[model samples]
Target: MEHLAYFDCPTGVAGDMCLGALVDAGLPVDVLHQQLSGLPSEVRFTLAVQPVQRQGQRATQVLVHPQGEQPHHRHWAEIRTWLAEAHLPPAVQNWSQGIFQRLAQTEGRVHGMPPEQVGFHEVGAVDAIVDIVGTCIGLHYFNITKIYCSPLPLGSGTVKTAHGIMAVPTPAVLQLCQQRQVPIYDNGIDRELVTPTGAAIVTTLAQGFGRPPALKLERVGWGAGGRELPLANILRLWLGSPPASALTEPVVLLETQVDDMSPQGLAYACERLREGGALDVWIQAITMKKGRQGVLLQVLCHPELVAPCEELLLQETTTLGVRRQWQERRLLPRRLVTVMTDWGEVAVKVAEYTGRRVNVQPEYEDCARIARTHGLPWKQVHQQVLHRFWQDMGQES
Candidate 1:
């Protein structure tokens, strides 16, 4: 029963489209409105969801009609204050804050100003507020634990903005995707598809971007873009659980036997493998041919990293040949959650299966660093973090 959502954005994605798709996927409008009611804004607006035809297919369009105030510029401080005063759910508040933070930081980089000082013009308006906040509320309501997205469509042509007409894939959008390593491409539509608001939300929240993952396909939500295009201009959302039979992908296993590499060199090679994107690396004692003792260096990596990982083994070890194999791995859905303790903040690795949490481990690096800094035993720091996380979880339950 693990829940996941995938955005299939062939046309592109925007804040409104995301909200619309979520609404279309069965998130109640009343609940969305209730949660968004606390936003510290004087402007009044209505979220209208209606059926629309995109190209030849049906989709949902969410239109915002705001009264009393038009789009206006807002500083980072102003938006931060609004979020803080809104009294959102803790998860919603934290997630929404991170999206806006990325937006401001991207804007700051594009405009040559500090992130705190950057002003959001087009994205600071009421509609943008509704889109971002509504999206968060919808996600919270659904209790979605995993998000995957298709390669984003970055349309071309100029777009009018508060700053003036800027290039397609506006500076803020470009910077956001580039910084996050989110993939983007042009489909030659000659229109602006991905807006800063859309980019910020997706880049901030998406765990991976590519083709949709293997899902059970429970419900599909199509979010419509504002413009009509030759191609279907809609964002399709897929919601489901991981396929019951498989939650695994093939990974490359690179192994080498080393007899002469120094301990310092072996450690550095392991470090290099990790830095080069090896999923894991380990050394094992073994007997080579002719009863010669050797260390077996094993590297596990994504298929894409096989070459670099193999090269490191060849260069860093005395082994003449590196063995490669493809191995399938089944993994639990996991993420890092930080727990604030007296010593400091420690990240707990949380793993879930069938929508139930199965294991939670405090990150050793955080515990060790805190132990050294506070002159406490590492075990004590670890125990304190574990205790704090369970206490918080208990209260939430």
Candidate 2:
């Protein structure tokens, strides 16, 4: 089964809430402690999980207390140094770095500075580190490959920050949402619901945003906020495999017979179709009614993009009419991993089924660029990448 985690943010989300829900879901506290042990000795914090009632419903509240005075401001480079020294898994390290990087970028843009020079105030603290890095470790422990979150309820009014009191949906949060294209809405509450850390985590790791996918019920964990609010003030996490029915999604298939279009135009049309969000586009040579060799251009895309894709076909190709139909697609659960090869870092596309990895292939574009740059055969580079990938997987296993 494909393992997935869906974050239900009815009240809102924060770093601590995400971590608490993940820990409460099934991650062992001891394992979390062990994984976090790699952090520098200067950073000390204790994770306390307490049972609380939010709006009369039981929830897990995670409070992270720093052991001593810590720097409230730090540059992105400093944080990266700590992560580089840690002996965490490559995946965890990458995930943690990415989240922080997104935060840094947002902060930098808001404060008019480069990302590496942007000083993190609330996010630079030891507790914030634990919340982010700890969350990554927890996700690794549960082998969570995909995450989905609901549209955030960005509160109204003002929120106190390092830069003094600012409007709700803080600058950092707004930048994060815009950069990642995360959906956000104000539910009329006048307080900060989505924190910077929370925005960074979700924007960085979440693959999709909307209602939970169709999945068989497995486990549920409720993570509570700091104080009681009008709403539940809890984040619900659902862990489960996608339902059998979700294996395929309805998509639109557009096809048209192209007997007169030139090969050049066909190539350009394929590129435009892809650029216009077509899932896949190709041509099949066929013999039309009068023994004339013709080409059939097929475009596959989301059902919603049918009109735009069809328009592009008509605008770019010499097709008078386009036939469209809704089709179901069964897609494998896949993720990309970058592996270090002799040439450089190569991204490997991995497709998994039934909880087991079924296919691993190097990204063709990366291999082609490497081959062209190094004056080597693309096939040789491909083989070398596969070899390195297997070697790395073997070592990790």
Where does the lowest 10-residue lDDT sum fall in candidate 2? Answer: 243-252
Q: What does candidate 1's lDDT look like per residue over 178-273, in tens digits?
A: 765566787878889899999888888886666667778898888888889989888888988877544755466889887887899999999999
Best by lDDT: 2
Model 2 residue 82 CA deviation (Å) reads 0.3
Question: lDDT of all the models against the reference?
Answer: 0.84, 0.85
Candidate 1 Cα outliers beyond 4 Å, as residue runs: 248-266, 272-278, 281-329, 332-397
Off by over 4 Å in 2: 244-397
lDDT for position 146 in model 2: 77
Give TM per candidate: 0.69, 0.69
Residue-by-residue lDDT tens digits, candidate 2, 6-106: 88997889999988898789888899889888887877888787888988988888788888777888889999899988888888999999999889888
